[model samples]
Target chain A: MSDPSSLLGALRVVLVGTSHPGNIGGVARAMKNMGLKDLRLVAPRAQFPHPEAEFRASGATDILNDVVVNDTLEEALADRTLVAGTSARSRHLPWPLLNPRELAGRLQDELRQPEHRIALVFGREDRGLSNEELQLCHLHVHIPTNPEFSSLNLAAAVQVLSYEVRMALVEQAETASRKEDQPFGTEWDAPLATSESLERFFEHLEKTLVDIEFHDPNNPRKSLSRLRRLYLRARPDSNEINMLRGILTSTQKAAGTKK
Target chain B: MSDPSSLLGALRVVLVGTSHPGNIGGVARAMKNMGLKDLRLVAPRAQFPHPEAEFRASGATDILNDVVVNDTLEEALADRTLVAGTSARSRHLPWPLLNPRELAGRLQDELRQPEHRIALVFGREDRGLSNEELQLCHLHVHIPTNPEFSSLNLAAAVQVLSYEVRMALVEQAETASRKEDQPFGTEWDAPLATSESLERFFEHLEKTLVDIEFHDPNNPRKSLSRLRRLYLRARPDSNEINMLRGILTSTQKAAGTKK
Candidate 1:
C-alpha cells in the first residue's frame, strides 16, 4: 500500500500555551532539523515576533514567521486525522502510555495507509497537557528518560520524538523499496515471518515432535507445548531453520549407523 | 603519565560583545550543565541586572550573579594554554576545522598527556570569532551542520561543545576502569577476541578462501585485503569465530563432493 502523500509534510506540529517564545523558535528549529516544517502555535503567552525568537531561531526563522496562530486547541486539531499528545507521566485517565519507540512503530504502520495526516500536540512548559486536552488525542507518547528525573524541556521533547519518527520513516521506506525490487513468488519474497507466523510454526512443530517420539506420546497431557512455544517465539530465520534441519539429519544418520 | 599539576579550573569561557544578557545567562546555564563553573564576559551590550536574564536562568542565577566582566579578549585568555576557537565556517588559515566528534577525539588524546589548561573560546552572536581572534587558538573546532544555513546561537554552541567534553570524560573513565579490570595477561578472560587469536583466524580463513578458489592465489590485491579488513574491523567474538570455522569446513566438504 503506497501512500500518495509524503510523510514529512503531512506531520503537523502544534504547540499549545508555549510560555517562552524562544522555545517555540527552538521547537521550530528542531522540527526543521528532522525534516518537518508545519508548525502551529495555540494560545501562546509571549509575542513570537520578538527579536529574541528570531535570534534564537538561527536558520529556522521561516518556520516561526509562517506559523499559524490559533486561539483554541480545537481549531488547531480540526484538520488532523490523528492526534498524539506528548506526556512525561501517566494520568489517571485510561489512556495508555506509548513510549517514543512504540509511538514511532505505530506511526510507521499508519504512514503506509493513505490520508493519514498526524498532529503531534505538545503542552506548556510548567504544566503538561491537561486531561481534557489529553482526551482529544488518539494516542499519548512518552519519551523514555531517566525515571528519577524525567523533566525534558518542551523543545527537547519534540526533538527526541520527531527524530525517532524521521528515522523510522526512512528505515521503513528503504526496506519497502528493497522488497519491491525482489520477485514476489519465492520463499525469500514472502513477507518475513512475524510472531503470528511463529505461533503457527509451533503448532506444526509440536505435532511433529510427538510423531517422532521426542515427546511422551503415552501421556497426551504431558505435552512439550511450552518448549515448542518458547523456540517458536524466538522467530528463527530461514538459515537457522536449515542449520537445525542439518543437525537433525546428522543425528538420524548416526543413529542408523549404530543400528 | 598523569600530570597532577594541570590547572583543571583555568579553562575559562569568554563571551565578547554579547547583544543579549539573556544569552549570557543561557551560556552560564549551559556551562553549569556540563560541569563548568567558571564564566567570563567581555563587554556585554545589555545590562547585567536585566530581569529577563534572571527569569530565564531558572535556578542558574549563581552563574549570572558571579560572572566576571573582562575588558578585552587578551585579558580573557591571558593565563590559558591551548586555546581553541569555535566556528561553523572554514577560514583560509592553515588551522584544520575539527567537528565536535573530531574535537572530542583529539581532546581524549590530549587530556592523557601533561599540558596547560585547555581553553574553549567562543565569540559573540552577531559576528563569530574574527580572523585575528581565531589565529590565537592552536586549533579551530567547527560544528558540522547544513552548509547553506549554518548559523548556531552562541549559547547553543557552548552547550554542544561542553556536552562533547562531558561525554569524552565519561568515556575515558569507563575505558580506564575496563583496562584496570582486564590487564594484558588476562586476555583469555576478556569477552572479545585478542589480537593474536584474531590474526590466527584470519590466516586460516584466507588459506581456506584460496583453497576453495574464492580468492585468486596470483594477482590478489584489493578484494582479499578488503575482506581481511572487514573481518578485523568486525572484531568477532569467540562464538562468532567458531561459527565461521564451522561454515568453512562445511563449504570445503561440499566442494569435495562437487569434485
Candidate 2:
C-alpha cells in the first residue's frame, strides 16, 4: 500500500483571495490533520507571516511555512492534471456537479494513475469560485450541505475535500497491498493495476458474456456496462480481480455444461 | 407549515472555547445567512471587541451585538434540554455516536416541544470536544465526513448543524400544516394544537398498536418505542398528529388483510 504521506505529497490545495490569515493558518492545520501537507495560497489578503496566522496554525506552521504563494489561480494550478473547485451554489455554466462521495471515487481513480496530479482549489470566504474560475477545473464538487443554508468556510471546505482525498487514497492503498504477509513499507516498486486495466478487464468480461449469449447484443440496455462502471468506481485490487475472474470462469463453465 | 421565522428563533447555537474572535464573527454571518439570529458564546479565549471579528462578520453585526457570552459550560447549558455536541473523533466515554442526519432527526423532535431550549455546541478548532465536555452532551453528533480526515472548523460545524436543524424544522412544519389555508405565525400560541397534544396522540396510538398485536408483545424490540420517542422528540402539531394516525390505521389494515 502506498503511504498516505506520499499520496498527500502528490495532492495540492489551492486557496484563492483568502481574506483572513487565520483562515490560511486554519486551512494549513486542517490539511495536516488529514495527512495533507501541500498548500498553495493564491493572493491572500492578509500576510502569511502574521502572528495571528501562526497562532491559529498552532502546530501546523510547517505546512504554512512550506506553502506556495501565487498571484493567480492559473499559476497555482499549472501542474495539476485534475483540478476540483468547491461551490455551494450551482453555476449557469455547464460543469458536472459531483457530491462528496462521487468526487471521492473519481479522485481515487485519478490518483492511481502515475501521471495524474490532483489539485483541490477553494475560493474566497465571502463569495466562492466565480464561473470563470470554476471553468479552469475538470470537475465541480459540492459538499452536500443543507440547501437552505450552504455557506461552508474556506478552511472547512479544504478540510472536507482533503479528508475525502485522503480517505480514497487510504482505501485504495489498503485494498492494493492487503495480501502482503509483512507490513509493506511506504515505497513499492510494483504499480498496482490502474483503473484503465480494470476497465479493460470489464470490457473483456462483457464481450465474453455477449458471445455466450448471456447478454442480449441487439437489445442491450448497457446493464453490463453499468456493472462495469460500478466496479471501476470501486477500484478493485489484485485479490479482488482474481476472485471475481474465478467466479466468472466457473459460472461460464457451469452454463456451458447445462447448454 | 410553521412560519420559518419562528422556527429560526428556536435555534440556539452554543460555541465552546472559541479561540478566534473572527471565527465567531464568521459564524454569525453563517447563521444569519440561514435566517438564524441567536448565538451564544461560551468562554471565548479572545476578547469579543476584537476588530478582526467585526470585520469578518460583515453585515451580521446585529447578531454579534446580541451575542450572549457565558462564563461557564453549565451557565451556557442551563436552559437547554436537548444538547448535541459536535465531535470529529470518538470519545473515551461511551456516549452514542450520531451523525448529523440522526441528530437532525432528534433536533426536529425537540423543536416541536414548547418550553424546551435546544443547544448545538461546537468546540475549539485545535482539539475538538474533550472527553469530559463530550460526556456532558446526551448525544455526540459526527458529521459522517471522510473517515481518514474528519476535521471540521468550529463555525463550519455550527453552520452545517444549524442548517440541518433549520431544514428539518421547515420540513416538519410543512408536513404538519400542508392543508392549512393560513400560514402559522412565529408566536408560540395559535389556532392549531401544540406539540403536547400531539404527544398524547402518539401515546394513544402506541397503546392501540399494542392492543391490536401490530407490535410484538414479547419481543417488542423498541422499534415502535423508538418511533414514539422520535415523535415525542419532534413534538408534532395537531395536523401532523392526524396525518400520522391516518398512516398508522392504513398500515394496520394492510397488515391484517395480508395475514
lDDT per residue (tens digit) for residues A1-259 in model 2: 5456555767889988888887887787777766777889888888777787886675788887898899999999998889998876567776887866568788777676769998888888889888889999898988644344466667666766666666566667667767563222222223345676676677666654543344333335454544553354334445345434543443344334222
Off-target runs (Cα >4 Å) in candidate 1 are A1-16, A29-36, A40-59, A68-123, A127-259, B1-11, B108-116, B170-259
Q: On a 0 to 1 TM-score scale, where does candidate 2 land against the true structure?
A: 0.55
Per-residue lDDT, model 1, residue A48, is: 74
**What are the per-residue Cα lDDT tens digits for candidate 1 across A1-259?**
2321246556889999988877887777766665677899889997877776775676787778789999987788775656788875655433445666567766776555444557899998888888767656656777543233344556656766665676566657656653322111223312323333333444544443433334233444323332331232223443334333433333233223211
Maximum-TM-score candidate: 2
lDDT, residue B64, model 1: 77
Question: Top model by DockQ, which number?
Answer: 1
Superposed Cα deviation of residue A99, candidate 2 (Å): 4.7
Task: Provide the fnat value for model 2, as a fraction from 0 to 1.
Answer: 0.05
